[model samples]
Target: MSLRFADGDFQSAWKELDEPQLDGGWELFTETMGVQIHRLYDEETGLYEYKVFGVLAACTPELCADVYMDLAYRKQWDGYVKELHEKDFDGQKAIYWEVKYPFPLSNRDYVYMRERQDLDMDGRKIWVILAKSSTVTPCMEKSGVLRVKDYKQSVALESDGGCGTKVFMNYFDNPGGMIPPWLVNWAAKSGVPGFLTDMQKACKGYANYCQKK
Candidate 1:
């Protein structure tokens, strides 16, 4: 598909979060470190889609966007990343990521296309990063690794008044295996918060890393 993301995609997500119906619509999962996690269940896939809102204290929108797009820097902070790189498949640029899983479960890999847009909404700068799985890529599957065929993620970043960023993320993916639904839900509920924590730490040291380069 297309690498670009429409503004409505993020705006609609924000609207849902703004007027939350926690009873049936977006259920509250957890909150930690200025982050709130909400989940919506899909009847067809029996999987949960996540909407996350957080503030990266003391971080600028530029820095947060840079850190999100920097695959090299991700390897240093994200321990679960087994492999990550960008490649061109018949002139179409895409990213390949292999993530490590716990024991007894196979690792997961994703081939996805991503795009970033710097938007000016009423004179306010908002950085949006959108990514989704691409089936057109000719990348071969690795043995013992499960390729995640369905995945999509979008993140919106904006300034939170003084030297901080407000982040909103909408993510969904299907592991495509015999994995239990409860296990998947549990992983997301726990893993998402941990990721945001790691991201904050990564942002803090990003300037230093750039200086050394």
Candidate 2:
């Protein structure tokens, strides 16, 4: 993978993601595993973008951001990912990811640039990590996977009270193939909760891993 990112690029993008366009279009979807999920349809895109927020006890915002941004630690937590790794890195980090989909839809893959930044709001700190599909010159689509080029993911973490991390997430993507609306909705509801719940578990596991090291 090849990427080009200059100084402050990640910060600019992170700041841009601070707003998710959910103003009045969002509608509640479900509350599961301590995450409150929502979705809103975008007529121009003919797709639904999802949002989720929750808080994890015994976790710090920095810990949550670290676990989310660290690619090496992702395999320990993310269940939907089949293959993930960095293809190239410099100031720009480009990676390839193959997502496992319950068949018979072809599994999807993406080449994305990962960006992360830290910001202070008032007196508290906020961490943001974002990923957007990109064209990497050195990477070619695998034969068996459908290339996903319209994916955007953002994860924002901040301290809640003392020892809790509040999470806010947004994901929007087009699978690049025809799929039923029901299945899409099902994935939207289930996927967000699963990711957050898994992150909660990862934070606990990471603490023990760090202490051992």
Candidate 3:
């Protein structure tokens, strides 16, 4: 898809996410494979907003950005995805995604508009992708699955001064309905790290996946 994001959007998002907020209510949620996950509680929604800081070793910022925006390739690497595809609403484009949940729990889905931008800050390069929940035509809610109406995710990637890409992410969403505290905790502590680990592996294989095309 063509980028709909402005240069300012990339700059502002990168400015906010490039640094970790260690103070305030943010606390260490989990750390694995050199990735640090921190979360802060939001009183208004009773949900936690997460901040992830890490590096994809040996991967360039451009390659990581490409891997992120490649939905077709994402299906091959991300096992949690049940259904994911891009839909166009008139002239606007959005994505519909349904994720698999553990048995006995209803699956969760999201429809959101997303855009990515690559910017050159003097000599340094940065890539940012932002997504937010949106209502689009013909993308109706599915039966038996809960729709996440309040979701936002932003990620920033920059060269790690070498061949690796420095990664930063901020994410939050309410899946609706009542969720067990243990399940939420598990997702934050274990799920986030596991997703990042999978992403790193996906980045490593992205180049090979493209060569066949």
Candidate 4:
């Protein structure tokens, strides 16, 4: 991934970070797989804000963050990732990612830049990653794969006061084209929690492997 900033676009994203307003348009959608999910709509943008959070038992903030940032490792565990490849690496970072949609729907893809940091919050050390879709340069955005025009993701991870890790994710994206409302809801309610479950498992693997090393 290209790690360079242009025109301070990333700066603006950092400025917008804040604790979620629990009493906004958000509503408790569903809790499954031990994860709590809340969703809200952005009517003006025809998009939704999905916030899913849970604790990863036996995982550390570093392990959780590492699993997420490792694109090469994602191929092993990301069931929906059809292709995830780093396109370039300079001061700026970029990657090409393609997600497999269930049959009959065209696959979706994104070219995005992800930046991460370790910071202190309320006396707890946490890892934060900010990812935004980009079109910084001519990318190998495959033909026939639908491009995600608008996408933003924030991931925060901190120690769960002990051996485990606490994770919170806020994601907003427009998958483009028409999609059934039921499908969208299902994806958010189930997909979000399922992804977290998988991530928890991945972190466990990392923690175990690191212990052996």
Backbone clashes under 3 angstroms, per model: 0, 0, 0, 11
Give per-residue CA lDDT, model 1, range 1-213, as digits (tens).
446557677665444334543566788888877788989989989888888888888889888999999999999999999999999988889999999988888999999988887777678888888889999887999999999999999888888889888888889999887887667867777789888888889999998998998
Q: What is the Cα-based lDDT of residue 132 in candidate 1? A: 90
Instruction: Indicate whether candidate 3 or candidate 4 has the larger TM-score.
Output: 3
How far in Å is the alpha carbon of 80 misplaced in model 3? 0.6
Per-residue lDDT tens digits of candidate 2, residues 78-185?
877899888754445578889898878889998888777787756658887777788643477788789988888777777877898877777788888888878887
lDDT of 3 by residue, 148-212 (tens): 98888889999888988888888999988788899999998888878877888898998899998
Model 4 Cα displacement at 154 (Å)? 0.3
TM-score of each: 0.91, 0.83, 0.91, 0.84
lDDT (C-alpha, whole model) for all candidates? 0.85, 0.76, 0.85, 0.76
Q: Residue 112: error of model 4 in Å? A: 0.4
Arranged by lDDT, best first: 1, 3, 4, 2
Model 4 ranges with Cα > 4 A deviation: 1-19, 89-92, 207-213
lDDT for each residue of candidate 4 in 83-164, tens digit (9 for 90 to 100): 8988754455577899998878889998888888777646657687888888664565577789996888887787778898
Question: What TM-score does candidate 3 get on C-alpha atoms?
Answer: 0.91
